[model samples]
Target: MNIFDLLLEADILVQISIFILLGFSILSWSVIFHRVFTLNIAHKKLKLFENEFWSGIDLASLYQKSLSRRNKLNGAEQIFYVGFKEFSKLYQMKRCSSETIISRTLDTMHTAINIELKTLEDYIPLIGTIGSISPYLGLFGTVLGIMHVFVELGKTTNNTATQIIHLQIIAPGIAESLIATAIGLFVAIPSVMAFNYLTTQINNLDQDYNNFIDEFITILYRQIFLNIDSVLNKENKHEETENKTCY
Candidate 1:
């Protein structure tokens, strides 16, 4: 029979499977759209933050501006704040060696990065799982329906008399099987796409964080440490000049 005829002739269980597949498709698509929106906003905010960070702008001023906003910022800014706070604290400590200070600064930044990574990745894995499994579940239902159809087909020995029941059984079973593929496609396409897209974004952000961390740390080492050493050397030179003049 024709496709419409098959659909029209499908049994209740097969129809139910189609409905379930459609539901999963809708749910997966919803997740895809939501995540896309979230990630896009995150990237926008992150770019804004990075530009502010590298602009020779004062961290204190930036921190103050960021803190004033109630819904103003994201994890990238938080990571920067944590790093800047550590840098300032170390600067105040005065007694620490440069090695100790830089090491502590990097350690703090790394921890903050890990926390932000987790926050960014929330609920994404579950979306991938739903995408991967929903189709298989649909296929399982279809298989069971087809098996029942065949079992019904085997029940009678008469040829023409059994054929009508066979059509009723087989039509829905075939439709159900085809829908399993459709459901599989429904679940798999967006899921694979979303999973891959999000993963790539995470990697890019991670690289951006690492690069910025290195650049900012290098800036601190040059500006803070060299200035301190220069002042100390000048003081020693002047003291020696005074001693020579007095002698």
Candidate 2:
């Protein structure tokens, strides 16, 4: 039988399942493309922010600059924004002495990493669901087709008393079973690939964010505790020696 004609004979409920699977495949593909573009942008933006962060501007400056509407927020921006806000709030509250500020800042950065990862990880479950279940749903369709084929076979045996040959009995059932499995794989393969690829990219971005935060905190430690008086003393002595030598 023609594949089209077999499709025409398929039960409505089974056809609906196939349609649902197809829709899921398309949605999963769309998500894959979107995440690919977003993750690429995130990587580039992270590189940009990491460069600026290494130059040793004060945290307050980074915070304020990020808070302003001018700096475009990307994945790195979000992670920094979250950490900086918490640190600033704690500093204002006098929650830590100077000695503990760095330790507390590390905690805040950890929390920021969680928040950013969760935000990126949203919708992952749905893709996973589609991948895991689509094939079984297709199998269910095939089962229904087989059950239907058996019923028709039994009816033919009573009417003309002609034995239903195995091939005739099995033909549509075999076709439907394979078609159902094919549809399932069609939905599942791409969904699984998309899920794994997006997950890897998200992990890489998260790691980059964490590394930047760790190094950023180290930079913060030095700048905040600058001994201004020591620098002035050296400059003052240099000036005194220069004046005496001139006289």
Candidate 3:
């Protein structure tokens, strides 16, 4: 018999299991497609932003450009916005030491990175859950179908003239039971593969974020030192002029 015929003749429990597996398949595919699209866009934007960041542009100019798209910023750009904004605030206040400003800016950027990662990971766990449980659900249906076949066979032996167990009688029922397992694996395999793939992408992005944060912090420290040196040089020059006038 064809697959449709077997499905039509399947036990009610087996049909329910098939339907549930189909639902999981649909849901998993939806998440997989969505995550693929989103991650692609995110990676593209990350690369574009990184190129702009290292192109010898001034921080204030970059910060202004980023502010224009503040609501839509993600990844490295979002971290830069929060960190720079905090740095600017503390620097302007002049109440905090350079160390305090750098510390607070680092904290702000870390928080932004965490929030971005969480957004990237949305709905991932649901995919993993479906992958893990779909096979078991399918197996449950198969077990019920096999039990049903055996019970019907027992009833048939009591009514039939021949005390014979036929392969033809048993094969179709077993085939129907096994279809559930087939459907279950169908749903599970892609879900597991997609889950692993997306997880790797997220991990790679996480490493990129950490590296960017470290580099940006180092830049901030250099800028702070440059400003301090410039101020000290101006003071020393003024003192030298005063000493010459006294002589």
The most accurate candidate by TM-score is: 3
The residue-by-residue lDDT of candidate 3 on 1-247, one tens digit each, is 8999999889999999999999999999999999999999889988998999999999999999999989988889999999999888877753345566677788899999899999999999999999999999999999999998887776655534433554466768989999999999999999999999999999999899889999999998897746875664565556543212211
Residue range 160-197, candidate 2, lDDT tens digits: 43654654655676575457778889889988888888
Structural similarity to truth (TM-score) of each candidate: 0.80, 0.77, 0.88
* Each prediction's whole-model lDDT (CA): 0.72, 0.70, 0.86
For candidate 1, what is the TM-score? 0.80
Give a tens-digit lDDT track for model 1, residues 1-247.
6655555556566667766767777777777777777778778887888888878787678877766772544567877777777877776754454566778889998898887778777777867887788778777767866777777777756788678867775556666557655666777777878888987887787887788789878978887877786654565555543222211
* Model 3 global lDDT (CA atoms, 0 to 1): 0.86
| TM-score preference between candidates 2 and 3, better one | 3
Consecutive 10-residue window with the lowest summed lDDT within model 2: 238-247
Clashing pairs in 3: none
Point to the candidate with the largest lDDT.
Answer: 3
Point out where model 2 deviates above 4 Å: 1-3, 55-61, 70-74, 85-95, 158-170, 226-247
Clash count, one per candidate = 0, 0, 0
lDDT of 2 at 126: 78
lDDT of 3 at 44: 93
Which runs in model 3 stand beyond 4 Å of their true positions?
Answer: 158-167, 229-247
